[model samples]
Target: MYDIRKLVQEIDKEHYLNELEAKSKKSKKDIQQKMDKINKQIEVLKTRKKKFINMLADEKIKHDEYLEMVEDNNNELAQLVEKKNEMLSMLESEQVIDNIDKLKQELLQFLNFNELTPAILHHPINRIDVKEGGTRVINYRFAAPTFE
Candidate 1:
């Protein structure tokens, strides 16, 4: 049998999770915006390339001029597509920092909880210290592990 008490000895706050969420939201937003911009540029380039074809068919421009414009459009499209791919890769990498969810899922495997409700448990109290002037310090057994 799985011991939930040992599995969940302490509830720790995911400090980096919050910070990463904020950063990733902004990063993802920024990357999405850039991708959208690239898509629009690609569409514009396609439209321009089509216009060049129409112009060539209509004999409105010389063959050399039309070919040059089409070549330029292709070059710009290639560059934009490359940049877009880089942005997509960055977005994928940004999602790699998901340890908090992994930890949550692991804990959830042993416990079923939807929300926090009041509970009375004395096992969590490790000890109570009485000092001078009747001052008391209550030490809890379940606490976030401290790091040096």
Candidate 2:
């Protein structure tokens, strides 16, 4: 059965996370920081957005003022939201995705390790080389043979 792909997947998933935690504190720290930052930015944008809506409902506001305020708030919110998404995408890379898949396969290989651990014995291409100079190829059974 095919297994190399599975082995890589398992290593990436079950092993890679733990390994990453040990290997790169900065990456982990950066992720936590980004998450907190994104959340705070989102709240701020929501509040600003709500205020813009409230302004529209105010009876005293002129049409030009309403449009200008709405446009400004929209621009700010869009910028903040875009920054959050960019950070998230940066943190999530193709390597990590591939590793997760590889880890799954490795886990499966580990579970059925007894079979994988066993060595395979195949007959050698060259059976024996004589010192003076005859070259012989191996035949699994002794009874076989014609000289090439």
Tens-place lDDT per residue, model 2, 31-59, is 76987887897788678767766877885
Model 1 stretches astray by more than 4 angstroms: 1-15, 103-148
Global CA lDDT computed for model 2? 0.55
lDDT of all predictions:
0.70, 0.55
Q: Tell me the deviation in Å of residue 36 in model 1.
A: 0.4
Q: Which candidate number has the best lDDT?
A: 1
Which regions of candidate 2 fall more than 4 Å away from where they truly are? 1-20, 94-148
Q: Against the true structure, what is each candidate's TM-score? A: 0.59, 0.45
Model 2 weakest 10-residue run by lDDT: 139-148
List, in order, the clash count of every candidate structure. 0, 14
- Across 97-120, the per-residue lDDT of candidate 1 in tens digits comes to 454466545555435655444332
Candidate 1 colliding pairs:
none
lDDT of 1: 0.70
